[model samples]
Target: MRVEQGFQPTPYTEGNPFTTDPVLPNLLKRLLPRDVHEEVYGDLERFGLKVLTTLHDLTSKTSEPRVVQYDQWGRRIDDLQTSEGWRGLKAQMQEEGVIGIPFERKYGEFSRVYGFMKQFIAIGDSDVISCPFAMTDGTSRVLELVGSPAVKRDIFPRLTSRDPSLAFTAGQWMTERPGGSDVSQTETIARPVSNASSPYGPVYRIDGFKWFSSATDSDIAVALARTGPPESGSRGLSLFLIPLRRPLIRPVDAPRPPALTNNIKIHRLKNKFGTKILPTAELSLEGAEGYLLGEVNQGVKFITPVLNITRIHSALTSVGSIRKCLAIATAYSSVRAISGGRQLLKDNVLHVAELARAHLTYRALTHFVFGVVLLLGKTECKVATDDEVLRLRLLTPAVKAFAADKASGVMEECMTMLGGQGYMEESRIGTVLKDAMVEKIWEGTTTVLSLDMVRAAAKPGVLHASASTISNMHQWANTIVSSCPADLVHRLAERLATLRICVTEVISAYTNPSTPLLSRPTLALFAYTTSALYLLEHAIWAHESGEATANTDIEVFRRWIDEGGLLPALQDVRRVKTAGADRTKMDAEIVYGNTSTTQVVDDLPISARL
Candidate 1:
């Protein structure tokens, strides 16, 4: 008898993300001017091929970076060494103008859309290069808004440069030992340097320890330091531009400044759960020289733009990771067989359903992020109306939180579809999953973001403005759904009504101090409703435009509105209203685990409780 080899699954071959993504091309076509769309489409196709080939290979071969704390002679040299692959990726990112596109503003209000679309496609394989690029973009925006003219002339060009040698990436250093997200607890101090100034701003000597600093290898950073009394909280803080290495001396021709001459000491690099290839470190800034970006004691206000931009980047990262994982699972399913090799996994209805569900989620998130991006672009171009500005403020945090919360589950679903192959590092899905998990925590945890959304909603006229926008979306969607089956139209109308009721109830609770507010759930309800509206609007556009994927788009919209758990969430609003005390008691029991004293203490209103 002859021995036969066992079966082997075919290797996964990834398609060009820009061209192969089911939703993006159509989305761009619908949103962009025809000529602009055509131009970007061609460019994206070529870039997409590079992403699948060059970028993919670079990220695959890249090793985690390491910090060499000392040299052979016991010299304290904090040399951050990264792989050749990492360097190549960075070079490509600059050469491709990944961070410069929006700043270049070749397309006016659509520039951000164009830039972010490229970012969304490239992020999956960029080896967390997006991390530094995001900070660079945010830093550039801050300088654009408030930097001294000298700073812009000297530093801004480098930030947006397409020439790899001329380009500069920036880090954001805000977290300290006393605070992660709470800048109020920041302990860094900046003491002014009299009769000293640089092209950047008024010079200061900063002395503090930054507990967590990502993009540690970047050329420069925007850091927050206390310039006021210790008791002043966040209002006492000030923003500064800190060059990571010492600047060259004033002479026209001079040797380079000695390493770490600025007194930035890299205490240690973090061993993180994900984004391993990116360099992150704790730093002691002992008399590190920095330049103030804006007015003193206004760091929080000046840093808002950076936070908003970075949060948007985080949302894109989350959605992009999910898209990449789904792509891998999808390609694998086509080659992998099931039922004793009688059928491919792609042919299995249950597997296909799971894939479809994940795709639906990806599609919804893409729309949400891009919608916010469009608003940002408008704001940047100075074309955003007051209402548009308000809508952007309300939606930014909600969308960021929503996308991040959905990403992990979608990643898990894709991984499961690939079985054991997905669990392996070789698949790259595991790596994406790991890196994507950081999105939730870095920008802000879901709970923190939910509270932010609640705060935004509570702002005068913000809630009403958002409700008005949603109502407008409903009217447009109703017109589109009118021609469909009565039941489908009825369902759409009912959901809209529920959304209105939820918004009304939230406003009522806000107005009436006696009513308990469920901040997290309210965010969920609004985010889900907004996502559904955006998806429906897209479906209508696709159908009206006679796009090839109109039917599929309509199906996605239907499944999202009907089976996406929005109805259950709506129903739960009633239960929450009636069962607040009971729910509170149960929550305390679950957390304290039958400890009566703890439960009683926890159940008390926050004003009366610890």
Candidate 2:
């Protein structure tokens, strides 16, 4: 319904969608700085293209559906050689060195490096790409090559420079175990192997097993083991450099097999639902020789920096999953038709509207997330104080958990929108759902992360640092509402104020030790709402500053609000059960669920599932 012939309008013209100057885009240039956040996001974005190309290649080559059956993964989740179908996939995996099947030269000589982008929905690491850590260890090096960088200085000259000729090769590792969230549990025993004729001088022997061993076939590995007893709860633990192959080297007169020389063995593969791309494995160390990283009993500390980085990257990965859901749901809504051959999209105006709404919401949410991280990365927070570290830790769990938890529902709703088609793999909604489901379990569960937030929430003499952030967002939301009935806006604002007070009171009451057991879930929900509002408020403000939501996005949101953004906005206010008004407005959003408002409000719309 855009105007082809109309009188030129002034600022905020209803007809001209691009009425506002894109000041925000320019503002982003000045305000934000060059940093890792931008770089990493860029990398992820590039990889996403790589993934899309990979998927496209897959689709083109498909004579039949790219089927993935559960049984193909062995009794253990990591095994993908169950039958002809799996073996076929395996050959394709090795041939492509990527996930998308019937593989072709998508990124020639690159082999579709981003094939596992959709694995975000996995419930566990046992998907196609079961072991991201295995391949990257969150680093671009195999653990073995990485573990003893200093010791391997002899061959450093050759490995020093990137190949001027070909694609950069990388490896993965799978060494995580069930019991170790913070540290490498010292279950495996390490002994300095003596009287052994091997290239590595004074090789140490390792015996025990590693669970969650991902990227087991990587170039190198860093396996942790306890040299002694329990007093070394974590103190006696040491990490070793287990390499896949010994780099060509001159013979050295020494006893004990030093580098990877057919000693360490992969025990089995884990079988699980989702993420069939990454490989998570299990391994047994039987007298495998090795070197150490950092210091003994210091494996846990050595891994912290790397672990945090991985968590952040994983957070982005989840964001990618969320994006996948949006794309799949949005596309499906357009094509799906209903009772009278009319598209479910246009036939049911609500669905079409809500899909548009949800797409914007997800984009904005992730954009804020990406923007924040980018801003933070531009600054030097490396040598931060204990307080700063605590803040980072506190925020870390929250971002990972919140993004992931919401993604689950978001993807599911997208899946639901497709009806029968979404249930199958042909549409990609299923993949979106699967990927979103896994985001919750990884890094930290929602509850686990929320607890961390609660623990870090109130500092001495402070109730809410984020409250001001929320207040600004409230002001902006109020702006949107102002365009509605003036009396209605006032009344609604009053109710919102009252609900905030009540919610705060309830939360304070809930925090008291005297609170009963029955209050837990209710309190948790309330706390979640409070926390989410704070986060959401920050998210919104990040854009309002003119750094984002300008240009195309602004028009998108404007169109959405003109339709029914207020309904969803009020719905959130109502979640705290503020006064309800304009049931008709609410119904349009509820029944249709197609606008950006719906996404920020609910994330997933019914059409996404179809």
RMSD for each model, in Å, please? Answer: 5.1, 14.8
Task: Summarize candidate 1's per-residue lDDT along 395-428 as a digit string, tens digits.
Answer: 8998889898999999999988889888988888
Identify the runs in model 1 with alpha carbons over 4 angstroms from their true place: 1-5, 248-259, 465-517, 594-610
User: What would the TM-score be for candidate 2 when compared with the true structure?
Assistant: 0.58
Locate the minimum summed-lDDT window of 10 residues in model 2. Answer: 12-21
Separately for all candidates shown, the number of backbone clashes (residues 3 or more apart, or on different chains) is 0, 59
Off by over 4 Å in 2: 1-50, 58-186, 193-203, 247-262, 337-339, 342-347, 353-368, 375-389, 447-610
Give the number of the best model, judged by lDDT. 1
